[model samples]
Target: MTHAELHADAFATLSAWTPPSHGQFSLREAYLGFLAARPDATARSCAPGHLTASAVVMSADRRSVLLTLHPRVGRWLQLGGHCEDGDSSLAAAAFREATEESGIDGLVMDPAPLDLDVHPITCSLGIPTRHFDVRFLVTAPPGAVAVISDESDDLRFWPVDALPPGTDASVTTLVAAAVARG
Candidate 1:
């Protein structure tokens, strides 16, 4: 399937899913509205917002998560980025981003999304935008080595019990969900 079709399918999957009891009540409604407002949402059409995919990457033992210090956000975050034309599905997009950013190959991803977050960002496209972030779970094999891409200031595997100081709470939640699902 094409990236657009994949996004539509993924959106449907997300729409039909029941949010975890701990999720914010408004997140689903915001994401659905973002979909309705932009037909090209999946293609980086960049109207009200754009489609972005993220992976909560875990080690084989599931005791640690790989996080990047995003240059733009200036905070530690899960590996992810905007969907690319080469991507065939949202899960693929997430996995691709994880691989590219983390420089780790042969990673395994869960097809179902772990969570969603909609937040505003200043785009290089010269627009104020929101990223409809569809998050998936990715697992790295034992002894996986990660090289930091130019997009990040640093890359590291953080203990599940001790994430970085600037790590978002939602990221911790996503990690918990991924661990639970595993």
Candidate 2:
């Protein structure tokens, strides 16, 4: 899809999603407002912030989650990243990130967003920016093996109840949402 199509998809996904909490509801509204103001909000060069797509990937049995040790964040977090220019939709961008990071083919993604988060960081642009992340739930096939991409310092699966120490709180929230969704 063209860049404009992906932006429209982002707006549609956030608009359709019913937040599980009031905080998320506020975030949803805030994101829609942001998108309304910035047509370039989907681009990595947006400077202020941009829409990123991420996946909380659960094992088929819901016993484990595939996480990445992000080189930048220096923490084990869910697999996801920025929406590419060629992405067809926000959901597809999320699925693409999961597939690329996990190196697992045929990963099943639920099109509806699982959660939303806005966090500040210096992304690839090498300047401080916020990631208005749109999170989704994806299921890796049973016995799926992940090959760590250059994007991560490491990659592996951890039991849902036993994530690594110092994992991001947002990651914990994502795991909870994935479990609840299952």
Candidate 3:
């Protein structure tokens, strides 16, 4: 998909999504507004910020979650990254990132977004900017094994309730929601 196509998909996805909470509702509006104002909102080149696709990957048994220790942030985070030109939709981007990072195939994804988060960070552009993250739920097939990707410092499965120390609250929150609804 081209950048404009991705931007349109982002708007449609947020428009069709029914926020799971009031905060999500507000974030959804903000994302929609951003997309409306910026045709390049889906691209990483959008300096102010851009829409990112992310996933909370659940183990086959649904007891543990796969997490990546982000190399840049030095923190454990869910598997995800910027939407790519080939991505047809946000869910596809999320699934693609998860699969690429985990090296696990046959992963199932629910297209509905589970949560939204906006945070400032110096991304690939090497400048401070925010990520309007659209998080989703992805499930690994039985016996899936994760291989750490170059983008991550480490990769492993952690019990949902026993996540490693200093895990970001956003990650913890996403995992909790995924567990509750898994």
Candidate 4:
């Protein structure tokens, strides 16, 4: 699909959910606000009821991106988790998640959001949990090795076009955008 088509699809996927974790409005509301401000465009906004941050970390040379195999999700994904109260900003939260999940310290966190993806995750009770994911594009030093954390069973760097099987489509779109921006 084309870039615009990919983003439209991603937005549609996020807008279709009515996650219970969001006590107030649905993600569609937040996405609508973002859409209105940049009508005929897509931009970033704080998703309603989303409390997590994530990062798609790339090598300094821009050859590969770091990915982790989530234990529960069983899919290759960017590093992220629920935001803790201690985090001062979403960018900080994404930076923290990248470091913790990849064990790669001294990475530089970008100020602007790389992408915004809101989706529902079903909990053990089969109730829909929601996350308004704020994704950043972080840059790691060359030749950096990633150590897997407990949250992930495996960690690896893969070329942008050669992502692992069952990779999240949102992540793929974000990475493509990041690469294009460069």
Q: Best to worst by TM-score, what's the order?
A: 2, 3, 1, 4
lDDT (Cα, tens digit) per residue for candidate 1, span 12-89? 967876777645436766777767766688877666778789999999999999999989889899999888877888
lDDT of 4 by residue, 30-121 (tens): 76555445332321222333345799999888879998988888888889876554565567778988999999978988766666677777
lDDT for model 1 comes to 0.84
- TM-score of every model versus the real structure: 0.90, 0.98, 0.97, 0.72
Worst 10 residues of 2 by lDDT: 1-10
List runs of model 4 lying over 4 Å from the truth. Answer: 1-49, 123-126
The per-residue C-alpha lDDT of model 2 at residue 50 equals 97
Which candidate model has the greater TM-score, 3 or 4? 3
RMSD of 4: 10.9
Residue 56, candidate 2: Cα error in Å is 0.7
Query: Cα lDDT for residue 152, model 3?
Result: 91
lDDT of each: 0.84, 0.93, 0.93, 0.70
Q: Model 3, 1-182: lDDT tens per residue?
A: 89898888889989999987888899899999999999999999999999999999999888999999988889999999999989999999999999999999899999999999999999999999999999999999999899888989999999988999998889988998898787
